[model samples]
Target: MLPTVRHLLSQPDLDLRLLTPATTLPERALEQSVEWVHSSDLSDPTPFLSPGQVLLTTGTQFDTEAHGDELYTAYVARLRQRGIAALGFGTEVIRDGTPDGLVDACLADGLPLFEVPYRTPFIAVVRSAADMVAEERYARHTWALSAQRAISLAALRPDGLSATLSELSHQLHHWVALFDASGTLDRVFPRDAFAGAGLPGTSFETVQREAGRLLGRGQRASATVLAGGETLTLQTLGRRDQLRGVLALGGVRELDAASQDVVTSVIALAGLALEQNHALAGARGHLRAGLLHALLGGSRDLAETISTEMWGPLPSAPVQLVVTDAPAGRLDAIIEFLELRVEEQPDRLFFATQNDRVVLILDRTGRLLLEDLCRTFGLHAGLSDQTDYRDLPRALAQAEQACERSKEGEAGVVEFDDISRQGVLAFLARTDAREVGRATLLPLINHDELNGSELLKTVQVWLQHNGAFDAAGRVLGVHRHTVRSRIELAETLLGRDLGTFHARADVWAALLATASVPG
Candidate 1:
């Protein structure tokens, strides 16, 4: 609350009189804050003056003998262009009274003009404004300290995170929102702050998109965004390597240094709360994993008792088991999202992690949720057929196998039933049969690697064409005779004849088994 022109004029000791008609000046112009008071006698003082300062000058720059309106107008225009808050003209010093030309310039330019009597020194005005600024600064600093104390107490509440944010919003007289690690809006203070169309210049969706981008980078950072006409500050919470969430303050155009300090304190408190919650979540995750192991070990009754006590009930008996290999970097975020989902529909979904893999047990109706999870996380999953709780071990085995198969496709999720329909070759992908096939094709593999020959590729292509030499040659971009020669050479390396269907079948299986293995 620095002194405004109106405030300065009201001071009895100052005895400043408005030279410009009070009615002619805009109310906002008169109320404009004066950051400092500067007195200059230079003809062009704009170089030393800053915006929002009251410029005081005696009539020394103007020649009293010369009544040139242009000189006064040009001088006033320069001060206006520099954004000087107001002009204070000292009268009875050099000239007899305030110049009528300067008064006319101030009126026409809409600059507030005041007259300082010769009895009052310019230093008195400077010190008066300085004391006012200091008082306001001190008041603001005290408010920040009080606000921080209140917020710290709020963090001691049972719902510390939400309570702290609510207190912060109240203190700032603005809105505050928290976004979880997955970029989901966890909560917003003053709950109805965004209830309807939301406040002007602040769109929750736009803020959320920005938060998502920052969290996706997985680093400790901060961003300031100007939306519509308002300003929003986003600060990442937690450590750089393990960010817990993002804290956003909206409708703040700018914060004074004191306000910024308060916000910093809130960020630290919020981050600590989230970290404590994370540790608790990790403990619960281990418990869930133990239940999953029990379900797979034929202890269905025991697992059900424990799960019912914790998360309502295990997904009803005939449930789908989904498995995915969770990347280490995103594992925490992934778990957090799943935990949120489970909380929303406790009876329909349950998840646990085992050795870098996440296993989900979902009711038949929860398939869509599983699909959404995979799509959102860019994960590949394998879903097992719905099976009774008693046979969860079999379902786990099937889901693990399908998860491996899902990695080879673009669908993101592969079901065990789909693989079963694909016949024996699909199942053989992970079998000991792969070793046998690799053994049978070892000679071709060795020859291709050693001689830079196309024997293995030619054999695979030829078999794919069902033994048609011309078709294989067309695919290999070689002559039919050369294809035949390569196939004959492959037969010699394997000590087998290629004319029979049995030999061709074995070679094709061998090729399929070694398809993913490096040459």
Candidate 2:
């Protein structure tokens, strides 16, 4: 703390005495902090003085005969306006004692006034105040060093991140909060800090919104805001491009240089802790991916054992698998959210990311949670039908196909059951099925290309006409006999009898599957 007027007067070496009645001084005026002690004798010393400084002067500027009471009163007013912490009048220089007019003016204006004995030189007072300021500065520096060391030790704890935050709050005497990369409040020091402080709810909300804006920019940043009569400082942790989280301090309107050093140390430690956690989370993610691979490869027992040992049980059989193509930027947030859910309901939800897409396996009752995830991230997801663990590979395929189909629909999530209800054509609209259809008709395609015959078209018309030769001929603008001959040629080339219903159905299905392929 800076030296106060009361502290200065209490010093015996300075030999200062209160000129104005002590009781008349404004509330806490005697305790006003003295930044520096400056001696000036100018009639108007306000120009040379700053706020919170002790202004010392000889009585030379005051002339009772020439300026009278008005001069002294105005001088006191000017000093007050300059925010002078206290006024000191050196006696027996140009005048024998402190002027009565000046004392009366100070009393009236509520400015603390003291008399500096002639025995005490102005330089002595200046030196005394300077030494006090220096001592306070040194004390604060020591505190900062000690605080940083404590915070560093806290960072070595098992719960290092949280321990560091708690230590920071203790050192700063302010509440501290940690926000995850997704701008969600992950932890707060002193659980009742905000509530016990009685801060307005909107204040916390404003801080949260500001945290979100900072994380949303995905850059290193800091922000200061005033809410509910308190000051808050927020700093983003980690690198500019890969922000790990945000650290916020409440009740800190500003930080002194020394305090800033302490806070900087805490930020560095917290950032390192978060970086370590991020690396560990990445490793766990890779493990999850490997586990998912094992599940798909039909090693259900091994996958389950590993998963149970690491993160509790996997979702039971008769689970619905969901696959989504969410954007890269939002994938981290999605995974983080799912991880929290998995922690809470380990046996009901599990997720992993592979090939730039997220795969989720949740119990059948988790449809609402899946929907919420899709809606929250604006994701297009394909959900597989409830299936046992043994059929995971088939389920994964179904989910992938449905996910592709979801892109063509308006909904954010589409289930395999919904796709199944569409018809056989919907199921056939896949890469493998399309390739098979193309190969099935390749013989006819090659025969038509080389001979310039209308065999393919004739077969298509005849199929559309439901095997009616007359109807097919009319549509093709050819005689019924010519249409029959073309159909015969198509059958020969296809090596399938068009006379049987099963063969006809197979040919029609192939034709539908390859409908979009260029000839």
Tens-digit lDDT track of model 1 for 1-519: 567878877778989999998788767898888899999999899999899999999978886467578889999999999999999999888887788889999999999999999999999999999998899889988999999999989998988888999999999987899988877777898898677533544568678888999999999999988875567889999999988889998884477678899999999999999999999988998999999988888898898888889877888868999999898767877887888787788889889999999999999898898888888778999999999988888898889988988887674888999888866764775466688888999999899999999888888888878899999999889999999999989999999899998888777777767763322
Report the number of the highest-lDDT candidate.
1
Worst ten-residue run, lDDT, model 2? 194-203
Clashes of each: 0, 0
Q: Taking the tens digit of each residue's C-alpha lDDT, what string does model 2 give over 332-391?
A: 678878988888889998889998999999897889988888888788899999999888
| Candidate 1 weakest lDDT stretch, 10 residues | 196-205
